[model samples]
Target: MGRILLIGGIGAGKTSIKQMLMNEQVSYQKTQMLDFSHVFIDCPGEYLEIPRFYHVLIDASHQVSEIWALQDATKERSFYPPKFSKVFRKPVIGIITKVDLPKANIKRASSFLNYAGIEEPFYTTSVMNKDGVAPLRMRLRELNELYND
Candidate 1:
């Protein structure tokens, strides 16, 4: 929790989740750049979508403490490749965003994260409804404490 970076495809709720955790208003403004705060880094989804931008994240990895490889439970296509987590030395947490969506598929999200080699105990969250946000925040705090210790 030194500085958590949220990485995922667009419309996957990274900004919403960040706002939820920050207790800020949930507006629909799209993140057009690599926006980050003192505590959170909300990466643009296009970086992950475009092959050339992978290096950007890889380079940016040096600035963050951990990575949240998020997936939209409501979306269909799997975006991550197998063992993708190996590219990062930082701890990777698999997050299934938009869990409150009508079409959420938790299993499929988890499957893709697992295939990507993300660590166990993946989290499911819905920023709008505040579902599963508290526990994740608590866990981040715990991780922060551990990092400090």
Candidate 2:
């Protein structure tokens, strides 16, 4: 039950993914300072709180197992420097959301990944249709296996 941190710009569907995972019958606990194992910390996506929260990933607890960066496919790439990338330099994954919307920019998302220098695999998903979510889950499981092996 290692920590899995979900990152992205605001409205990138982090909460939606958290809610999806929470609906599963798994043990989870949340507190003011921190959220426990099998839990998701709902970090503020605003500009100021970004660095403050990401430092938690660098803890020596060996807790943060993965970093999932959610992206809004309908929008262009964020020009902000990838600060979170520096903190959670562990297994990273990209999640491109809003597949239901028109003009989804998967290529731009991939470009963003390339610009961020993230070699880890990524997936496109829509929580509404459940499209691409299963593959993401499978990829996470595969990553877990590889990490453990």
Candidate 3:
């Protein structure tokens, strides 16, 4: 299987999503650096939050098969800038995280992703409840098949 790189703002649930997909115990923890696993590359949120660290993400993008640009559904602002995905040549998938939260706004999150240049069919997920996890997993599997074949 190919690896995926997760990028998003702080507390956007990137680590939680990685833990959920890897079937590891999901716990709240700050990512201090780049984390490499068998099927995922978990990036620190600061890489996306800081403009100078963008090169780190762009350089790291070469090692992964796909890039996931995540947006916290409850966050009012987006860490991603317009056409952010243009920096990566690989497929960039948009994901709306923490969708099960009471204050989550899927529409706004989707628009944020859209402005970032991530197209339609954005996935919504809530690691706490495992909502939308199955479909996202299936889609990842499909992408792996298509890329690795």
Candidate 4:
């Protein structure tokens, strides 16, 4: 897969999903700054929450092949404005995290992602339980192929 960038609000499972994708030590650590890995680039959630910080994401987008706009199903909030993904030059996808949470709302999460301008079918993943990530991996592979072609 080509380098992928993970963007989302705080506690939206960006770091956890990165661990799952990288097979790294699965633990929670608040990303203080942009954490670059071989497979993914994880950015702080505050960047998405504050419009002033969006420039960080815009700049980082230039370095990656794809952008994942994530939202946690467990918590519903409008962090992204209409068609926010369009801000990035790279292809943008949506991911719904914490799908295994007790009160997770997948439908609402999909709506939020759609509102944020993710054109393809958004992924729903539960990093803790290791569920639904395979599809995402497959999708990433597909994206990589298209990007390379």
Better of 2 and 3 by lDDT: 3
The residue ranges of model 1 lying beyond 4 angstroms of the native Cα positions read: none
Model 2, TM vs. native = 0.71
Give lDDT for model 1. 0.85
TM, every model: 0.93, 0.71, 0.95, 0.91
Cα distance off (Å), candidate 4, residue 8 = 0.5
Error of 3 at 140 (Å): 2.5
lDDT of each: 0.85, 0.62, 0.92, 0.86
Report the C-alpha lDDT of model 1 over 42-71, residue by residue, as the tens digit. Answer: 888998888788888887777788898899
Model 3, 17-119: lDDT tens digits are 9889878999898999999887888988999999999999999889988898999999999989999999998999999999999999999999999999999
Q: Indicate the residue-level lDDT of 1 in model 3.
A: 41
Candidate closest to the true structure, highest TM-score: 3
Best by lDDT: 3
TM-score, predicted candidate 1 vs. hidden true structure: 0.93
Tell me the spans in candidate 2 whose CA falls farther than 4 Å from its real position.
24-39, 47-62, 79-86, 140-149
Per-candidate Cα RMSD to the true structure, in Å, reads: 1.6, 4.6, 1.3, 2.0
Candidate 4 lDDT by residue in tens digits, 10-121: 8899999888777788898999999987668899999999999999999988888889889999775769899998888888988888989899999998888888988758
What is candidate 2's lDDT per residue for 51-122, written digit by digit as tens?
554455456224666777777888785633554465555766777788878888888877676565565466
